[model samples]
Target: MLKRFPFFLMLLVGLAVASCKDDEDKPPVTPAPDTVSFVATISGSQQVPLNASTATGAFTGTYDRTSKTLTYNVTFSGLTPTSGHIHLGGPGRTGGFKVPFNSLTSPITGSQVLDQQTADSLLAGRTYVNLHTTAFSGGEIRGNIQQGTTAPVPPVEFAALLTGGQQVPANGSRAGGALVAAYYPATRLLTYNVTFSGLTPTSGHIHLGGPGRTGGFKVPFNSLTSPITGSQVLDQQTADSLLAGRTYVNLHTAAFPGGEIRGNIRERRLGITLGASINSAQQVQPNASAATGTFTGTYDRTTSLLTYSVTYTGLTPMAGHIHLGGPGRTGGFKVPFNSLTSPITGSQVLDQQTADSLLTDRTYVNLHTTTFPGGEIRGDIKVK
Candidate 1:
């Protein structure tokens, strides 16, 4: 009996050891990471029916890998949102689009295909969010998504100049063969217009793919027409994707269908403009180059315009201009200025077409006068 009891105890011990070993060999079961969320606020000026007004809205979205769904909830306080959607593509990268939500009042959400291709592209930073409006008819606001973070704020808007020069003139507008680009801070909207000094563009349009890709690639947001002052807007999804530094703006013409002007858009930290006026007291002092006196303002959601007052130290404020390119300090050829006159002050209509340019930070503001031949004073339009 004692021997039998010992055998039984040994058998039980061996069974327990085997069970522990089996548990150790089993695969680990880890809980998925918690979902991340963010809120994107869009505040900018837009062209309305009778007059141009400002629009202010916010969007909340979440990306869940466990569910493979991207959900959005947008709200507008100042103006009404006509429509909006989530698009696919990087800043300049071109690709097909899938519409998730069509209206702004309701929650916009959807899931992506859980595949190796989609996952790889996402990791490579090739996705974004976009919202549209009636005034823009295109996309009024845009934002991109990245791993580890949710609802990152976009920096100040800027423009990309086609002119080789890096500085803007204080007097006459740089109306040479240039394309005007604009950016919106909150929505990251980028808008662009290609002007040929009265001569229409034969086959000019904005390229969505990177600079390495072909110039005559597919239309960015839609078919961009030339010979007209009219502009086109890029999708928010596309614009957001651009924030990852994979997108670029490439202008094409019959002479250079592949591309004429090309530059990567980024956030603006400074503004350079030439301001001069041959007036009574300041005839000789037509050039402005003072650091203390600069044009600064706040965006009025009521009007969708940036209200600002210019304080001159060396020169007088005569004509104001805006460009879409890079920081110009010396002498650069930028596009026409989007005037923010009366009803709105220092406000550029951030429509669909111009929104695309603004996202790339390819826009600038300048004060021009007759005194400064090229440009007396230059300051970059930076965002706080």
Candidate 2:
């Protein structure tokens, strides 16, 4: 019986070992998914006012429930989106859109830690993608949240000026031509207007070459014998090449089959205009009115320069200046106004820092007075 007992004990031990070995040889057990991904097709069905039905789009994204993070990517055709958001709603149902996308670039690939409300909505599948544009303030395209996957989009935005002088190394092309091309980052749409003189080219093309080096053609056009104007939807690689500043417009002439007038492509002349109306409501003392003014400004992004066209009246202006401030709040001095007195009307050049501050659209124009040393009337500069 003792020997039998010993054999029984050994048998039990062997069984236990065999069980553990079986577990080791088995495939790994996968943990439950901690992230959710989805894709949405955008079309007129989700559009507001029944318009912009022509617009089509796609949105793909992933939300990590554990980390409370949301990453998204979007692509759209038929319209440009000025603002985008993930709104709280349901399929076939519409709701308020408040969750904003900040620092947005092309393809809408940005990350935002989901707030409690947004996270809840996402889990419940009550969140959707919304895009707003100039024509459609409500929404141009939208899609309900679903489960899927989407890769991120490459960021590319470009503009280029066509000129004989901007040619590679030296623009020896006595044949003159000018072209302005603007490429939409998200959709890869290329729209251009070209006019040329001094040479009749059989064709024109945007070649894969830079300031000093010349390479093969990337996009070709019909004979530019006449003024060339139209649009072209580019592929991904071609768009990337254009945005890298490795592209140029070279007119093909019978005289020079290789190329004739060539101008390097780059971001075209860029500028922004800002202005705001003055009212007592915008002042520290809302009642201190009758002292109104207007702030007009234009900024050249390339030069980092600003030109101000300011005019004010209805106050004994002690001084006029551009102050860095927000809505209903005041900030420190940014740039001094030329004329310290009232009826200040003139143009002033803003330094780089001052120009940058205005670009934020947060600054205001302050007119000081002896009676009201703080400020008489203020107008917040609004980019136009």
Q: What TM-score fits each model?
A: 0.39, 0.32
Residues 35-78, model 2: lDDT tens digits: 88877877544432223135667877888978888888777777
The most accurate candidate by lDDT is 2
Please write out the lDDT profile of model 1 over residues 35-71, one tens digit for every residue.
7554554433221110122344556656667765666
Model 2 error, position 147 (Å): 41
Global fold similarity of model 2 (TM-score):
0.32
| Candidate lDDT (C-alpha), each | 0.45, 0.68
CA RMSD of all predictions = 12.0, 17.6
* Candidate 2: residue 313 lDDT (0-100): 71
- Off-target runs (Cα >4 Å) in candidate 2 are 1-269, 341-352
- Candidate 2 — what's its lDDT? 0.68
Q: How far is 153's C-alpha from truth in model 2 (Å)?
A: 21
